[model samples]
Each structure stands twice: as structure tokens, then as C-alpha cells.
Target: MTVFGCRICDTALTVPVSRVALPVHANQKYGNGPGSLAPALEPGTFAVNPLPSGSPWRRWAELEAGEAEALGWYAPRFSISAGPVGQVLLAPGDVHGAVIDPALVGDSACCGLDGGEPNMVCVTCGAPVAIRIDDCGLRQATWLDPLTTHVLEDGPGPHPVLDWADLIDQRPGIPPSEPGGGWHPMWAAAAASALAHLLAASGGDPISIPNHQVAKVFRPTLDRLLDPGSTGPERTLVLAGPDIPDTGGHFALIPEHPQTGELWPVAPPVKPIPLAWDAWRYLAFHRTPKPVGRSVPIPPEALPALLPGHRFEPDGQIFLSVLARLPEVRQPRLRAIYDRGRPYSYTYCSF
Candidate 1:
């Protein structure tokens, strides 16, 4: 358990939180209706250094020659988040003894807060301590400023971290469906990292994915990116994990450790493509529509749900950012894709 408090008064600002190795795409923004927006981190969880945004933006030219390179940035962006350390991200509703500063709000035209610096202040001392971001196009989170906040306490207590077996059994799936009848935005964001590693492992060669609803989400992007005619090796991605539903290929797509964010282990010469645990569960224990007897004279085997017809789309910004961080981007064929900004001339539009 951990409780972060305001440095000035030592008053607890946050509820007891546990460490969470959040996804790489945690910061990737998704467009959501004003009324339906959800916080980035789950309640009772907190992630550190989850790419803090705002105020401390730095231009590519402003960075020292080796600084950007050291940051594993092979390409350039308009600006980079040169934000502060000790950024403990939390759900907005989780913070106690704190309130939003109406005067420091961001993107006034929108229904939610966006990029106001130190928008959150200590309720007791009025000390500027954190940033509250909940804009429509950004991930909603409360970012604790290290200078104004200190960890009052953190220690293991009752709820321990789940091991791989327990996590697999839970089947807390990321359903491809969403509120407005489209593919979930989280799936799209996750595709960025998953696709990056898959492409890198392809070695500028062809790779195939088995036919499955979840696999279909990735197949189009993978095919377009790894054009066999345009590009070394060949591989077929096999859904490999404990009790994963599909099976066969030597090339494995497995879940990283949910708690540690560590990629799963694979034997020599076999590259492990990391899949988010939530998405992995969707593929592993897919719930097919089964027949249920009807008293109202409806068809017995009626479908449970109808998925949207639109193709699964990857978030372009996140996809590019993910690729640039991989060593395989140095490969000319793959590098060209990164340099071009997006994989396709026209991106998949769920909306």
C-alpha cells in the first residue's frame, strides 16, 4: 500500500495505492464522448513516470545533440515531453484533500480539463501539487508533481500481486466491442506496441496470423506493413500462452507480465511478441454465441451481439512512436515506414 501526501502539510492527497506497471500506450489519447470519458488508471492503482505531459515541452532543436539519441528517439516529433520525474499518475476521483483550480483550466471549449499546469491543488494549504487532464482527446489522469508531493508510506499488506496462473484464470478480457458499437480504443492503442514488435520480428519479411476475430483486428495492418513482395524471412504468429485457445506456429504472441510489464520468455531464435493481457484473454477464452432456450419464442441460437463492420484501426501517433523506439527501425525497409509518419496513406477510421 502507498499513500502520497502534500509536501507542505503532509496531508494525504491520495488514497492507498499500489504500484502498477502500466501499458506503454497508457498516455495515448483516444477520442471519447464528453459524457463517457473514463480515467486512465483503474481505481486503487497508480503508475509512475507514465510520460508526463504539459508545461515542460521541449522542441527537437532545443535538445542537446546526444540527449534525443539517448532517449532512444531516432526520429523527431514537434516536441517531446521533457516533463518532471516522480510523476505518480492516478485516477482523478482517487485524490482526497485536493481540488481542481478553476482558474488554471485547459481547453476551455471542451467539456473536460486538458492541459492546465498545476490545475490540482492541496485542499488544505492551496499548494499547487498536480495536473488534472481529462480532455476528450487525451487520457484522463491526475499527475502528482514530485516537488510538491512526497510518498508518506508504502508497504505490502493484504491484496498481493497476482502471479501468471491466477491472472490467466481471471479472464478479465478486453472486449473488441465498445459503447458506440466500434472497436475499443484501448485495443487500437495496444496495437501500436504489439505491431511494432511483430514487424521488427518479421525482419522485413512476411508473417501470417491465424484467422480469429481478435487476430483479424491485426491482420490487415500486419499485411500492409509487411509486404512480402516489397520486402527476408517468413513466420506465422501462434497464440502461445497458458491455455491460449489457438495453437500451432513456432513464432509466439504471448502476454507480458501484467504486474511487472516484462515480456514473456521464449526459446532461442524465437522472438516473443508482447500482447496485452486483456486482449490476450479475449483471444484465449473467446466466448462464442451459444444457444439459450427462449420462452418468448425467439430463435434458440440467436447471436449474442453484432460487432461493427469497420476494420480495426491503429492509432497513428502511437504506432510511429512505438516503431521509433525499436532497434529494428534502423532497418531501411522498416525505417521508411517510421519516417513516413504512418503506415498507410489512409488510416482506418472507426468513427
Candidate 2:
């Protein structure tokens, strides 16, 4: 079989051919999708100008590397600590470019790659360097598993090209109104890149992710809201839509319970407007790629019934899903809120 690949890099000694032609197409390629690849690609012949100082892109790269390295130190609480039998820990979110699976649920050794190997070359740049693949025997390490959503231990650093997954039940958590660490777009982008890198590294394996690992990356807004020192207006609730444009809607996130007067806390004790699947799917898919930190529209009629003294503005266009009862919403005809700001972008709505 003619297993083609770019020759600017080297090949595995165990492979059929020890030396392949230069810049030939490879056996696989992982597009910008779930379960991608993270092979050590050879650097190219040419050198490009460096990025400007303190650019967001530069910071993002550092955050990505930091998050990946952080996985190396994470310990799996689910694994039997009696002693190390044979084990291997995988981080699929690091490998896959998308968040196909989040949270750790169980343990296994093999994971299925969504699109298999990546063979495509980066047209923007070229490679010219020596490369070789060796059977790096597994070392005892810890990482997050995308499929099982757990943290587990396995053989040493830099495992061989093996598809691994842990056998564990999936425990899906309620999707958060604000994904990533915080509501800011920059923070979301950085966190998403790191999380995506972690998933991609796992090769979509089923593994256990420890609670500490989740807490390390997850910044619960609830914590901030409860902090008595926080000044200014706090954020308490969020309303979002799905990736689908026409299906978007909004809801208010409230604490488990409200205390004191109508002047409610804005940041901490927050969740999304209680919505069913129809409304949720729309918000989940249509909501912006990053949280915009905006609130749902409180109709003039409902305003009186809502928390008093708080001003409510129809922030963005509510893409009401046809499948559910239309939210009792009325937008100001003469003025538009969505027109003044960017709308949320979601994966489902891309099509």
C-alpha cells in the first residue's frame, strides 16, 4: 500500500517504507472538527516574521500550551490506587479540535477517532526538518478522557499511536449558560482552545476526569457572585440560544433561592432561564460562540412582575424556535437592540 506523507519530515521505522517522497499527501487529515490529531509535524524551510508584542494570539498560544501541560499533572481519582497494574491515561479533548465530549465519566484503554488520521498540509506554511516515530512505551501519567469524561492513569508520557478510551457511563451535566472560564470573548477563546487541545490529545478516549481538574478550568460565576467584596453591578442570570439562528430564545438564570429585597444579586447564584429541550437546543446551538454577557428581554407587561427597580432591555434578537410555544416577547419596533450589537454565533447555525 502506498501510504503517502509529506517528506519534509521523517517516518516510523516499523512502517513499510523507511523513507517517503517529499511533501506527498498523508494517509489522514483531521479537519476543524471533533476528534482531531496532534502528530509532531516537522517545521518548514522558511521563517516568518514574529507576531507583534503582547498580541492576543500570542497569549492564546501560551494558554494552550499551559493547559496541555496542566493535564500532565492532573491525577485521576477514579482509578484503583491499590497499585498500578497496566494502565494508560488519554486526553481526547486535547487531541480533538472540538468539544464533542466534556467531563470525565469512567475508564477504558481505547478511543475511536471521529474522522481518523489527518493528512492535510497547512498551505500557509511549509515544512523542512527531520522527523521519526518511535514506540514510546507508555508511562504512568494522568489526563482527562473526552468519551468517559474521567481522569485516569496510564503508561508514561507521549504514548504510541493507539486509539484508547475508558469504559465508563456518560454523566452529562446541565450545559452552562456561560461556557469556558468566563463571559468575555477573549477568555472563552483561550479556554476553548485549551480544552479543545486537551480533548484532541485523548483521541476521543473514554477516561475519568477528576473533580479538581474540572474546578481548575471551570470558573464558577456563582463563586464570584457570593464574594461580598465584589463591587459594581454583578451578573446573576444568563439567556442564550443554540447554533441555529431561527431557533434562539432567552431566559433568566437565578440562584437556588432568592433572599433580601427585590435588588437581586447579579453575578453569583446564576443559571439560565428554566427551559425545556426545544428552547434549550435552540439556545445552546444559536447562542454566540462566546457569551456576550447580555440579558434576555423582559417584556413591558412582565416587567412589573419581574424584579423591581432593575432595568430590562431586549438585548439581542430572540430567534424563537418554531417547535415551542412562542415566548411572550415584544421588541420595540422603532428601535432595535440586535442591530446595534453582534449576534451570537453557534455551530448548528453555521449551516
The backbone clash count of each candidate, in order, is 0, 81
Best by TM-score: 1
lDDT of each: 0.72, 0.21
- lDDT (Cα, tens digit) per residue for candidate 1, span 24-139: 65676665555434566678888787454455778988898877666667666667766666688888888998888887676563767765578888989999889887776677
Q: Put down candidate 2 lDDT per residue, 73-191, tens digits, no spaces.
A: 12111111221121212222122211222122212222432221121121222221111111121111112111122122212223222111110112111233223322222222222
* Model 2: CA > 4 A from native: 1-4, 7-227, 236-351
Give the Cα error of residue 202 in candidate 2, in Å: 32
- List candidate 1 stretches off by more than 4 Å: 50-55, 107-109, 245-250, 289-308, 342-351
Q: Relative to the unseen true structure, what is the C-alpha lDDT of residue 35 in candidate 1, on a scale of 0 to 100?
A: 45
